[model samples]
Target chain A: MKLHELTIHEASDLLKKREISSQELTRAVLDRIESVEKKVDAYITIAGETAVKQAELADREISRGNISPLTGIPVSVKDLICTKGLRTTCASKILENFTPQYDAFVIKKLKKAGAVIVGKTNMDEFAMGSSTENSGMKTTRNPWDLTCIPGGSSGGSAAAVAADMCLGSLGSDTGGSIRQPASHCGVVGMKPTYGRVSRFGLVAFASSLDQIGPLAKDVLDCALLMNAIAGYDPADSTSVPEDVPDYTSFSNKGLSGMTIGIPKEYNETKGLDPEVSGAVKNAVKVIEDLGAKCVEITLPHTKYAVAAYYVIAPSEASSNLARYDGVKYGFRDKEKNSLIDMYRSTRTKGFGAEVQRRIILGTYSLSSGYYDAYYKKASQVRTLIMEDFKNAFKSCDLILSPVAPTPAFKIGEKIDDPLTMYLSDIFTLSANLAGIPGISVPCGFSSAGLPIGLQLIGRHFEEKKILTAAYNFEQATDFHKQKPEI
Target chain B: MKITKDEVVYTADLARLDLSENSINRFADQIGDILEYVDTLNSVDTEGITPTSHAIFLSNAFREDEVKESMGADKALANAPEKEDGNFIVPKVINL
Candidate 1:
C-alpha cells in the first residue's frame, strides 16, 4: 500500500521498523492531496511545507529512540479547532483571516506527540448544519461519489481520511457532526463522552454537547488518536478528571460476553431508508454470530431528541457567538454609523443564511418572554432523554443502531429545507445529549454504492468498550478496507 | 409557532443582526417551522424534572488563584479588526 493509504497503526509500524521515513510518508500524503484535492475539496488550508518540516523533526526523534504511536503520523484537524499561526475559520467568512496566537489543548497534545499537522479541514459554518454545503468557503464532496455529501459538519475531515489525504483527523462533534460524516464517508469516527476530552480550544457550538474526537480509516487508528488527546485539563472547567485508558489495548477483544441493545425506536424511525436498516440488522447478526446477544431495547424519549437539540444547541450558539460583535476580532463593517449599527451590519454580512437563521431561532428562544417555553422546556426534556439512555444502558453493555437515518444524500438535496436537514441527525444526537461515547464503523453499502455505517454507543467514559466492539466488527468485515475510488 | 415578520424583526434586533425585508419573511417562515417542531417538547410531562444545563454533573471548577502570565497584547490584538495603542477600537460609545 502507498504511504498515504496506510492507517496510523500500519504507518507507525513501518516507521518503527525503519521501512519508511516520516518525511517520505508526509510527502506521499501531500502528493495525494495535491492530486485529488480539487475533486474532493477536503481541506481549507494545506500546510504542506510545515507538515514536511514537522515530519523531519519526528524522524529525528525516532532516530533518537524517542517516539509515541502518533509520532511522525500525519493528521488533519477540523477548522473549528484552534491551531496557532494557521487560519482556523470554522468555515465562516467572519473569521476568514483570523489566526490564533496559541494552539488549542488538543493541538498542543498532537504537537507534543510529534504528529505532523497536515492542514485544516472544512465544516458547516459554525457547525450548525448537517451538510458541509453550509460552509461559507467551499463544498466538500463525498469521496465515494462526487455528487453526494460527505455527511457533515465534519465533512471535510471524513472526506480527507476517506480519500487518503490524511492518516487520521480530529473532529468536534456537537450533534452527530463527527459520526454522521464518518458514516457517510465510510470510516471510523468516535465522539467520546462530553467531558472525556477538554473543550478549551474547540470553537463552542453547544457548550454542554460538544466534544472533540478522532476520525480515521479504522477503529484502532481512532483509538490511538484518542489516547493522545483525551484526559482532563485545568484549562476547561467542564473537562472531567477521569483517567484515560490504553485505548489501543482494547482493539482485539472479541464480542463474546458483550450484550448489544438495538433501540426499537431507531428501527421504527420514520423516513429511515430500508437499505440502512437492512445493513444495520445484518451487522447485528454478524455480531451475534460472533457470540454476542442482541436484544431489542427502547429509548422512549428518542423522538424528542431532535426537538430538544434544536432549542438547546441554538440557544448556546447564540450566547457563545455574541462575542463576534465588531471590535475584538473578525470582520467589522465600515459603513455603519452607530456602534450598534456596526455590530448588526457586520453580523448580517459575515454570517451565512443558515447561521443567521439559527442565531435568530436562538435569540427568539432565549428572549425573556419565551425563555420558559423554549429554552427551559428543552433543558427539562433533555433531562428525560438523558434518563432514557441511563435506563436503557442498564440492560445492555452497548447500544447498536444506524449512525444516520440513511446514507449520504446528494449535495443541495436538503439545504433548502432546514427541518428536513435537522431530522437527518435524529439517530446520532441522543448520544451527545446523554453525554455518552459513540462510534460509527462502516457496516455495508447501499445499492447505489454509498457507504452505510453502524453505530455503537456506550455509557459515559466507556470509549474502550465501544472501541472494542467497533474494532471486532471491523476485523470480522472488510467494509473499512474498502476505500472510495477517488 | 406562527412567527410573524414582526417577531422575526424583533428577534433579529435582539440578536444585533440586520435582516433585509426578504430575509425577514424567509426567517419568519423557516423559524416558525422549526419552532412548531420544537413545540412538541411541551407535550411531554416534565413536571418535577430539574433542568439539565449540562450533560455531565460537573461542579464549579476551582483552580489556583495565583497569577499566571497571559497572552501578550500584541498577540491578543493580532486579529483585531481595528486597534489603537494596546486596545481594540470600536465605534464611539459615550458622547461626553
Candidate 2:
C-alpha cells in the first residue's frame, strides 16, 4: 500500500519495525494532500512544515522505544478545536485570523503521544449547518462524488480521512455533525458519550451536546484514536470523572452475546431512502449472522428529537456565541459610533446568514413570555428523549440504525431550505440528545455508488460496546475497505 | 406560529446583530417554519418531567482555589482585534 494509504495502526506497525520513517510517511501524506486538495477542499490550513518537524521529532522518540498507537501518525483536527499558534477559525470569517495561545486538552494529548498535526479541517460556520456548504471559506466536497457535500460541519475532517490526506482526523459532534459527515464520506466516525471526552477547548456550539471524537479509515483506527482522546480533565467541569478503558482492547471482541435493537420509529421514519433502509437491514442481518440478536425497540419520543434539538441547540448557541460582540478578540466593527452600535454592526458583518438566523431564532425562543413555550418545553422533551434511550438500553446492548436518512445529497440541494436540511439529521440527533456514544461505519453503497453508513449507538460511556460491535461488523464486511477513488 | 418581521428585528436587536430588510424578512419566514415544526413539543405530556438543562447529571466541579499561571497579558491580547497598552480597546462603554 502507498504510505498515505496506511491506517494509523498500519503505519504505527511499520514505524515500530523501522520499515518506514515518520518523515517519509508524513511527506507522502502531505504530497497526497497537495495533489488532491483542490479537488476535495478538505482542509482550511495545511501545516506542512510543522508536521514534518513533528514527524522528525516523533521518529527520534520512536527509535528510543517510546511508542504509542498514534505515535508519528498524521491526524487532522477540525478547525474548531484550539491549537496553539495555529489559526482555528471554526470555519467562520469572524475569527478568520484568530489563533489560540494554548492547546485544547485533546491537542495536548495528541502532541504528548507524538502524533503529527496535519492541519485544520473545514466545517459549517460555528458548526451551525448540516453541510459544509455553510463554511465561510470553502466548500468541502465528498471524495466519492465531487458534486455532493461531504456531510458536515465535520465534512472536511471526514473528507480528508476518506481521501487519505491524513490517516485519521478529530471532529466534534453537535447534532450529528461528525457521524453524518462520516456516513457521507464513508469513513469511521465515532462520537463518544458526552462528558467522556473533555470539552475544555472545543469552540462551544451547544455545550451540552458537543463531544470531540475521531474519524478514521476503519474502526480499529477509530478505536485507537478514542483510546488516546477519551479521558477526564479538570479543565472542563462537564467532563466525567470516569476511567477510560483501552478502546483498542475491544477491537477483536466478537458479537456473540450482544443484542442489537432496531428502533421501530427509525425503521418507519418518513422519507428514509430505500437504499439506506436496505443497507441498514443488511447490516443488522450481518450482525445477527455473527451470533447477535436483533430485536425491535421503540424510542417513543424519537419524533420529538429534531424539534427539541432545534430549540435546545440554538438556544445554547445564542448564549455561547454572545461572546463575539466586538469584544476582546475576533472581528470588530471599526466604524461604529457607540458600544451597542459596534456590537450590532460587527456581528452583522462578521456572522453569516445561517448564523444570524440561528441567533435570531435562539434569542426569540429564550425571550420573555416565550421561554416557557420554547426553551423550557424543549428541555422537558429532551428529558423524555433521554428517558426513552434509558428504557431502550434495558433490552439491548446497542441500537443499530442509519446515521442519516440517506447518503450525502448534492451540495446545494438542501442549503436553501434550512428546515429540510435539519430533517436530514433526524436519525442521528437523538444520540446527542440522549448523551450516548454513537458511531458510523460504512455498510453498503447506493446504486448511484454513494456510500451508506450503519449507525451503532450505546448507552452513555459505553463506547467500548459500540466500538466492539462496529469493529466486528467491519471485520465481516469489506465496505470500510472501499475508498473513494479520488 | 408565524414569526413576524418585527419579532425577528426585536430578536436581532437582543442578539446584538443588525439584519438587513431582506434578511429580516427571510429569517422571519424561515424561523417561523422551524418554530411551527418545533411546536410539536407542546403536545408532549411533560407535566411533571423536570427540565434537563444538561444530558448527564453533574455536580459543581470543585478544585483547589489556587493561584495558577494564566496566559499573561501579551498572550491573552495576542488575538485581540484592537488593543492599546496591552488592553483590549472597544467602543466607548460609558459617557461621562
| Residue-wise C-alpha lDDT for candidate 1, range A48-102, written one tens digit per residue | 9899999999999999988899999999999999999999999998999989888
Candidate 1, A347: how far from true, in Å? 0.5
Q: Which lDDT tens digits does candidate 2 get at residues A263-287?
A: 9988789989999999988998899
Whole-model lDDT per candidate: 0.93, 0.92
**Number of clashes recorded per candidate:** 0, 0
**DockQ score for model 1:** 0.88
Candidate 1's docking class is high
Interface RMSD (Å) of candidate 1: 0.9
State the weakest 10-residue window (summed lDDT) of model 1 chain A. Answer: A248-257
- Scored against the true structure, residue A61 in model 1 reaches a CA lDDT of 99
Which stretches of candidate 1 lie above 4 Å from their native place? Answer: A251-253
How high a TM-score does candidate 2 get? 0.99
